[model samples]
Target: MPGKVVCRDEWLAARKELLDKEKAAVRAAAAFKEQLRNDFPMVKLDKAYTFEDPKGKYTLAGLFQGRKQLIVYHFMLGPDDEAGCSGCSFLTDNLPSSLTHLYAADTTFVLVSRAPVAKIEQYKKRMGWDFPWYSSFGTEFNWDFNVSLDKDVKSPVVYNYKEMEKPFKGELPGLSVFYKEGNDLFHTYSTYARGLDGLLVTNQLLDLTPLGRQDVPWKRHDEYDSKDLKAN
Candidate 1:
């Protein structure tokens, strides 16, 4: 047998109290997000490693200039030959609304990739994206986030996909952050593996579509949708 229950308002009030006081837990989770931000593991981009773009020459740290916090999305783009990944493109589609909020809060968001600046810019134009995109090609930039991928970003042109067609490997989608303090810049967080899971807003929304993310399932993906719960 279970204990007697309280009135609805009492239950709601109790839950709200815990929800409001969860900052310590939130801060602990943020510590995981701030892993790279505090240590600043992102190395400074070298002149030799510089890339030519329609916007002109730029480096890694230069991307976060004049901003308090930098939130970078590791967009899935490889080299010139691969075009781009549709899955990542879908993720990028979910960014604008959030970008507006981040701007209101004074945070900067940009998309980083292993593709050339020219390639990235071209895709942005094609997709009509307004968010800033940068190239991490020809440097340790991609590997730093665990997505630019080793064999492709490193040097080898073969052994991954085509025997001799495509040259470089593509980057997996991810999100990273950085902070600036006067003249110093710190790499705050870099999410890979499941850290990129939060960007799956598109997948979540799709589950609400007529067919849902899974075609065979008879009902909605309640499990995934339940991730976004509020106090009853």
Candidate 2:
């Protein structure tokens, strides 16, 4: 039935029931998110990590600049790649608007990626993003934040390519937080893998989709499903 369609009256009746279940599920998930926030308390950062500014200068305690709370997005830009991840690119786009409220709340937002400063800055300019992006390359920041796996011994294919016995396990995207208390900085919280979930406004809206996120592995324009790893 190429052009077959269900009877109009029957379709409407079925849709109504579907919508009711969808509504309940939405409320439940939102409630679950709220509960997780309270139950899983996040702490402040105690260990300091150095950062390379977009200008190619090195600085530590360098985040949030003059703000009280420091929020760093560990963008997933694999060292082998010449660019940052597209999902991170999307979050960067949102920052222009979020900056107003975030600044007002005394919260500072920035991106921390393993890519070299030169590379990170290049992408920033190309994307027309003015938000702060720093290079955490050759730094322990990534591993400390649990965003990068330990620089473990590489596999055979890696050795055949770069010929280095040991290489970074590569970087994953995440969000880290720190709070300033007088002169000392305390680690408040850190989100890794899919911990950056707050940036997904599309999936938030898609909860209302006819089939929902689980039904369709990928969103409209995206052909990949990185959400699964994060969800796990």
Candidate 3:
């Protein structure tokens, strides 16, 4: 739908009003982030969880790579699936090409999946993703994190810190944050479902437009055809 036509003076007045609200929203978000950093509780991780990547195995603390903080995006690529989730791929596409800024801030970003290292390598090569990716296969990392669901692993599945209404057998997308203090590792935060909306740059940009995202289904970057490239 087209927006209402307005005189330049009227448009300016409306824009100014919206700008005030936008500034207020920004301030509110900053306050919430302050609480996340200063007030949130951290859970000490004692279990020995192992993960494998192209370079071999790594423990949860090993993922920190000498950094004080770690951000892990749980990519939904199960052992039986041939590809990763489209929604997860969408968010991965928005990740920074260089990690220099995060590294400078004593933080590292990585992706974890339930598929084997060999499978992860194949898909990572196909997607041309350079971020550190590891496989939690043969381990309870995914189950413990509440991203992967398997009746055999544990019963009465929970996600977003609540019991799932329906039985699910696959992987779900989520982001988990960890803090490393010397030899100890702590899970500081985790967000699932729509809580991850802030990570998608495209969605954030589209939200500023009148049409917003239009409930469009996301596809992998390579999967978009010529028509999609042209946006026909």
Find the candidate with the highest lDDT and give its number: 3
- Which residues of candidate 2, in runs, are more than 4 Å off? 1-46, 56-60, 94-98, 151-168, 211-232
Question: Ranking under lDDT, best-scoring first?
Answer: 3, 2, 1
Worst 10 residues of 1 by lDDT: 215-224
lDDT of every model, 2 decimals: 0.64, 0.67, 0.92
Clash totals for all candidate models: 7, 9, 0
RMSD of each: 9.2, 8.5, 1.5
- Backbone clash pairs in model 2 (N, Cα, C under 3 Å; residues 3+ apart or in different chains), count: 9
What TM-scores do the predictions have?
0.60, 0.66, 0.96
Arrange candidates by TM-score, highest first: which order? 3, 2, 1
Please write out the lDDT profile of model 3 over residues 99-136, one tens digit for every residue.
99999999999999999998899999999999999999
lDDT per residue (tens digit) for residues 55-84 in model 2:
655445657577788888878775677767
Q: Model 3 reaches what TM-score against the true structure?
A: 0.96
Name the lDDT of candidate 2: 0.67
Summarize candidate 1's per-residue lDDT along 17-129 as a digit string, tens digits: 97766777788879966874465466442233343356776755566546677788877777854556766676676666547778667688887777888788887877777
User: lDDT for model 1, on a 0 to 1 scale?
Assistant: 0.64
